[model samples]
Target: MKLVPLTDRVVLKQCEAEETTKSGIILASAAQEKPQEALVIAVGPGGVVDGKEVTMQVKEGQKVIYSKYAGTEVKLEGEEYIIVRQNDILAVVE
Candidate 1:
């Protein structure tokens, strides 16, 4: 099954957490912090939502940064994804 977001919602696949520190120290799994960066999987059509005229600025396949505590986690066909409102996306990575 495919995921289709609705109403300004965005679907993202989070980037993997770093296993080692920049100083070359390997960290345990429990110490790894989830990365805020992700690749855009799917995007919802932007329109009137909650009386606001919203337009989608991001597109599929773009890498983005989002709020630390945003979106809902979902598992589909053994793959994981996060769904969040467009506003939750902070910036798109070049």
Candidate 2:
């Protein structure tokens, strides 16, 4: 992928959770409770800082959970994606 996020923005590949519940309950696509968590794919170097470029704390492949409504959606190479800032990310998953 040739995607290079600008400023502190980061490109995240959303990970889809299972469509079925473990208790044998099937959920419809429209019934999803939250946006799937994601992985850090390509991240911007971080926003400008005091006249200098700051580096982001997030690295590629790191798992993160963000607001369900965050990010700008896009499609690249026929796959969907989301671009959000490092600060927008709520927490890093283990």
Candidate 3:
């Protein structure tokens, strides 16, 4: 299944969190924090929302940083993804 965002929403795939530290010490899964970075899987078409004209700045394949608690999580085919509004995306990673 694929996600097709409506309005100014964006579909993102969470990037894998680091399993090891800089010192090469492996961390337990329970100790790992949910990563705030993700790859843009799909983008919504720009349109008027909330009485404001919104344009999508992120594109598919771009890595982005979003709010820690932003977006709704969904599981499809055993893979996880997030759906957040365009404004929730903080920055686009170069």
Candidate 4:
């Protein structure tokens, strides 16, 4: 199944969390945190404004950093994903 967000919302696939530390030290399972970065998969059409339509600045395939609790979680095509407003995005990963 496919998800299509509405009105300035975006869908993203959460990136995998780091499994090891910088020094090649393996981290325990309990030390894992949800990855803050994600790959944008889909975006909504521009949200309506005062007699105008403002499109989203983010685009598909862009990697972004978002709030830890930014979006609503859902399962699609047997994989986990999230949907959030463009405003929820903190920054675009280079």
Q: Once model 2 is optimally superposed onto the true structure by TM-score, how far is the C-alpha of residue 28 displaced, in angstroms? A: 6.5
Report how far off residue 62 is in candidate 4 (Å).
0.6
* Distance from true location, Cα of 44 in model 1, Å: 0.3
**Each prediction's TM-score versus the true structure:** 0.89, 0.78, 0.90, 0.83
Kindly list the per-residue Cα lDDT of model 4 for residues 6-73, writing each as its tens digit.
88789999887658788999876558877789999999997694576767999899999998877999
lDDT of 1 by residue, 51-90 (tens): 9999999999999999999999999999999999999999
The full ranking of all candidates by lDDT, starting with the best, is 1, 3, 4, 2
Q: Taking the tens digit of each residue's C-alpha lDDT, what string does model 2 give over 35-74?
A: 6589899988776855777779888999999877779998
lDDT of each: 0.93, 0.84, 0.91, 0.87
**Model 2: residues with Cα > 4 Å off, grouped in runs:** 19-22, 25-31, 47-54
Total clashing residue pairs per candidate?
0, 0, 0, 0
Clashing pairs in 2: none
Candidate 3: regions farther than 4 A off: none
Ranking by TM-score: 3, 1, 4, 2
How well is each residue in 1-94 modelled by candidate 3, as lDDT tens digits? 6889999999999888767788999887568888789999999997999989998899999999999878999888998889999999999989
State in Å the error of residue 91, model 1: 0.8
Task: Give candidate 3's TM-score.
Answer: 0.90
